[model samples]
Target chain A: MDEMSAESRYADWIAVHAGQSDLRAWALAADGSVRAELTLPSDSAMPEAPAFEAKLLDTIAPWLGQGSTSVLACGLTGLADLPEAITPVPAKPAERLPIRVSANDPRLDLLALPGLSQANPPDLLLGEETEVAGFLAGNPGFDGVLCLVGPRTVWVQISAEEIVSFQTAMTGEFFDLLAGHSTISAAVASTGMDAEAFVDAVSDTLSRPERLSQRLAALRGQHVLQQLDPSVARSRLFGALIGAELAAMRPYWLGQQVALAGPSDMVDLYARALDTQGVSAPRHASDGLALAGLARAWFAMQEHAK
Target chain B: MDEMSAESRYADWIAVHAGQSDLRAWALAADGSVRAELTLPSDSAMPEAPAFEAKLLDTIAPWLGQGSTSVLACGLTGLADLPEAITPVPAKPAERLPIRVSANDPRLDLLALPGLSQANPPDLLLGEETEVAGFLAGNPGFDGVLCLVGPRTVWVQISAEEIVSFQTAMTGEFFDLLAGHSTISAAVASTGMDAEAFVDAVSDTLSRPERLSQRLAALRGQHVLQQLDPSVARSRLFGALIGAELAAMRPYWLGQQVALAGPSDMVDLYARALDTQGVSAPRHASDGLALAGLARAWFAMQEHAK
Candidate 1:
């Protein structure tokens, strides 16, 4: 980082969020204040030891020194080595003991953070736990359901600082696959989203969720029969999927204090979808929550050592 | 074909069924008995005139004579040039006028036949119309619904040999895309069908058509948490999708004489899914119906000439 020298102990520590798409690392000083941030394309969803170590070094090596600098990396980066990365729920999000990486570098102390898992509905999360912890850090006494919208949208129930249960929907994956590569890609590829169209489609699908496949085919039919606006078509596709999800997940967000977290853009989309249902979703920056969660974990580990 | 020599009027005419994946054509005698059958990969869903003409000639040229041998073609082969191919419903499936293909070969008389369309529900079918015609040709007095399964599965409401209305579902497309490339592909890539798992999943989703997305996600969760058999996982995934479709199309199959048409394997899958709902779906050889419908169109065209 430009803020400090690279000779020795340049960064006191580092916190990283390695996800399916990319890896984000923040170099932190002793006070847990971030000095600089670096991002790189991820190695894989669940990266192996050698490749994960190489990526971590490439991300943090310039900031490393001859002395030990602890690296607290969360997400799928080192998950394969961390057999305990899936912590059973009804406990703190940061309850699992992060596995130490089998490393060749002397100045490295790497810990792979584990995500939370629920047994009832059979659900698991990769990196959202850190963000949840970060949300909890900001709102210590807050108790409500958190909707984290990302590549995989997760509906989490929280009370007394423990993750009670969660439900995940493959809505994002379906959206990506169908919109990018499927036959509906022509209708889904648009530079803009139509708000009115999105609302209408959401209502339609919410009222009749079972007709989702038929509605998907209708997108193509309407595109062919009528000159359906690309923006409107895209919005309608998203709306149908989100609407159906909301109907299925009514028990999760029907009458609860709800907050939305993720990248602001996607978070806003979910916010708008929930708005149609007359549910107000407060927004939280996913990256900020992630950093906060990582810091909280680091702070707690420090406390445990003390 | 080897059954007939390449000479003048060795075969009276040809009936073709061109679809999204492939094209099937039959050289027939004047009485409509199939002299020989041929199948080739389709040019495209809606191919250009040049490619369609080339493929048609390539398929039928060997059997053509010095005389203008009439070729009656149907499906997506020549659909692009036939804007009027979408024959409006409340009419016979073979009611649309066939468009003549502009050709350089003097001995080939190729005509592109169109399929039936419905406006209310916004549906389209490329080649399924011929199969419906064949079904009607055999059962002129029958009145009920037809489920045509393929790249896109269509449910047609037939009344007294005339098309009433139809619904198109992207179940096949969705199933193909998800099982091939999605994150849960590992769970879906199986070689066998688990009947019990499929039936159970069908009932589960039939009772809860709204929870389709969650059930999809649970496939992955269960695969990871438990020793989920690949075949069972694949069956569960299919059952969920088809179950949801059946729940939506309950009105189409409930208390109706339903016939399933398509490739035998896919038709059997739909047949099984419908059987769970206490509906008996008679299987129809899709190719036979397509050829029969084409021959019927040829016969009617000749009668018009007379």
Candidate 2:
């Protein structure tokens, strides 16, 4: 119960993810079991580098012990800007070495993971790279498109355990803005989405994606005419956005094996859109994948160090 | 001043144009000349009906007389929602009579003007109807199309003084949301758009509209690759959005006499895009058009009342 057991538990490392608004860290046992988790719900992406160490300690300091804890980080990496994130198209997703951050706490050895970027057709992604790496770790033989749908939907073409190329769309952010802030919000009901309406709207826009702007305005018009139900109109607005995205991404997914990752509802929505287009893509729960990717990257680092 | 002069000034009717965020009123003298103006900066689009009078008096109380003054109101009509706003497509702009409100003040006679709407491809406009009407009043023989750009852009096809059909786009609002709030902001400079970049992006997108999302992501990519200037990327993003809009609106403006009305900057952008397509659209400063339309509606109401 004394030194040996304490060493076993305290030898554990942490996997960290800092998003646009929140910070999350997982306390993992030496055997790779997640023993506990900590979350700081705001101001994690503080733009300044100094905020990272304190924000990390605020959540996982109690878990730190006599030995140093290696913290592998991604997303905003607890900072709004990281100068060293790699442009890793045509390279393995998790191949880049983690950047050793200057840690003030001797008990904390922090490493911010490098995010992937595409040089041409320009796009960049942070935490999604880790999730993609996790996906590859679980299915090493996978070789095709992976559509990670989130605040920004990222579509990466993977082959031989590396990302060949990728593109991103603002569909998720646009949907949130339109449904929550735009005048379209008044035309549609706040809570529910009609499945049929969503599919129908997607089909309509996919056939002629340029009509997206018109289709959106039509939702408002339908509201004025008292024609479409509020929920139906809301779903249509959502469908229209995704449809346009799918249209743009046609080159990326068409005639290729596709996989999906993200929040369940988003995965389901993207899956439905793909299903309509006769594409079958396997789905992965994105919540745990970032940590899995972080763990994989850590293990790789250990192997490299050896 | 003397009693007679006070009466002359107080008898002036006020034409009010309330938008989603601001209220503007032009005080018209008895002879139909604009005597003065009033502006209420915020919260003027209060949804409650009772707010109409208090907001009205906050700006134009000094101009009020012992006798009742006709207040022609449009836009949100000092309210967020108006049940009686008419869907009046295929009718002359500003032809609808003002809806009489239940005014508590004997000296405050308020009348809310009906906004025009198209039921078919679904579109609605409040203050824009007044602007179109103002445009028609100034150019009575004009009979083609009007592109009224703002936070929400409206496209109206006119024939024989009637709005035969119309459409609306969220281009302006989308630009604001993307440039100000989305990740795109970090990729682009905060201000100053490059003209060549804007024109080139418009040309690129107008040829392939479905690539709108990709073009946006490319701006972010360009940032990571350090290939494009920040202001150039920003302008390209702006151009891509407008170009997509122009593509969607091809049917609306093709082979038609078109007029552009909006803020000077927006008008210039639209005009440039249209110019790329070899279409020359006359520019109309939208600042006074709303009040002019409101005044026109007020005069028409007076004629009907007589």
Candidate 3:
């Protein structure tokens, strides 16, 4: 199917499900024009396997009733329980296998669509590059990637070609830990970070990274001696450590773009850091990325079948 | 004087001080017998200098106002702010200073006792042979000694002696760091510990105490692999390490007694641990230990002057 027909078909399926009491829909508009729309069940509580399957059928039957709506997609394994009328899209190898709703009947169309799968993958896939590569190698029918970064950063890189992955320590998380709980943490308390002081400390340490351990020790000593507040020292230590990590990781993504993900405030801070280093900002979106990526992956799979 | 005369004298003093709006009276009773009393101008907050003299004055002032109430007969800090009126009651070198107060400082009288120099003493006097020796050595007194036994197990020891001292560590705190925020912390989420698990771990490792490092490594591995709950492992690690410290310190106390002081709940727990190990429970009280010790010291100074 051409792009226009494919778009029209997806729209009709959404429209048929729009009035269903059990479904919730969200539409995104660009320049006053509806760009895309997605729906989920309003009362989609899955009970037992059979009940879950019934709900899945109830959710999708209307969409399937629109004969033109040929493809039904879900990122959860629960959707795999749908009647054969709903074609369950196979997850790309890079994507996570939907959690089995029941062990006895594994053939149920309960599998989640590519959108949800790509949006949030399994915890095991987080921060593991080798596993990401393995996932991609196994599932070549995925397109697009969604990366979650912050306290526990996760990358869900996807393409119809498969998933590629790498995981890194949450330097931000480390910074928080040191600030809040460590003996070194006490030094920074009561003293808010002086941005200039932090930048100076970071710059100094980045130039001579081996001093990080010694600096931490000294800061801890000063705190115990009551010479410094723990919080201030904590902020400085965090800034220095994260700065070092960033400096180290800079070479890895030299040319490749990285999309900013996670809480907006954190993303803003990261964006500022990236801007300072003269790196280009990567494209970013919340839910849209997963939806568009899933659509693209589904379209590619259809073309391959044709 | 008989009890009636003593009561009459106290009443007169109280009447006199009652007219002084700024003065506050605090009565001391031992085993339901009126032992001593003190009255002070609440406006004259505890001063920071001439530490011993100020404490002595605060201790005996009320008794002196009652017309030479015999300190030798009572053997207590006779009233507040008149230590010179009391005769010193010499004590055995190892005997803790004698003073008594209620469990919590619920009464304003108990709190109004001039600052009992207590808390951390100067480092030089730590591990001194006796409280008397500590006093003679010019060791600053302590108000209280808070002994943390494990992550959640704490024992507060108050010094009924002229000088007080205590120790601290990062065992429980470090466990929190490792289990809550560290890379390895994630491994132990959702694990539970049997009450005996830690005790068993400690006992087993006692023969080869150096095995602690190895056990820690194993626990860390299990946790990081998500085979154990981080909290359980963290608590276990804390209990094991603290248990080891207790085991080491138990021998040093030998036949000597120890008073567990702090919040009643903490003292009870420590007492239970000691009981399980067949250690004898000594007298435990909270507020007046330091004050009593200071009072005894003041009496000693008065006798020396005489």
The prediction achieving the highest DockQ against the true structure is: 2
User: How does model 2 do on interface RMSD, in angstroms?
Assistant: 2.5
* Better structure of 1 and 2 per TM-score: 2
Q: Sort the predicted structures by DockQ, highest score first.
A: 2, 1, 3
Error of 2 at A131 (Å): 1.1
Ten contiguous residues minimizing lDDT sum, candidate 1 chain B: B1-10
lDDT of each: 0.79, 0.78, 0.38
Let me know the DockQ for model 2. 0.57
Candidate 1 stretches with Cα past 4 Å from truth are A1-5, A8-12, A41-69, A78-85, A94-96, A104-108, B1-15, B25-45, B48-71, B78-84, B103-109
Per-residue lDDT tens digits of candidate 1, residues A176-273? 87787665677667968999998898899889988888888787666656658888999999889998889889888999889998777778778898
Per candidate, native contacts kept equal 0.58, 0.66, 0.04
TM-score of 3: 0.38
**Tens-digit lDDT string for candidate 2 (B166-244):** 8888888788777777767777755787999999999999888888877886776677567577788878987998898
Can you tell me which runs of candidate 2 are displaced by over 4 Å?
A1-11, A20-22, A42-46, A78-87, B1-11, B42-46, B78-87
Query: Where does model 1 sit among the CAPRI classes?
Result: medium
Backbone Cα, N, C clashes tallied per candidate = 0, 2, 66
Q: Compared with the true structure, what per-residue lDDT tens digits does model 1 show for residues B160-205?
A: 7778888887777788878887767866778788899988888889
| TM-scores for chain A over all candidates | 0.93, 0.91, 0.47
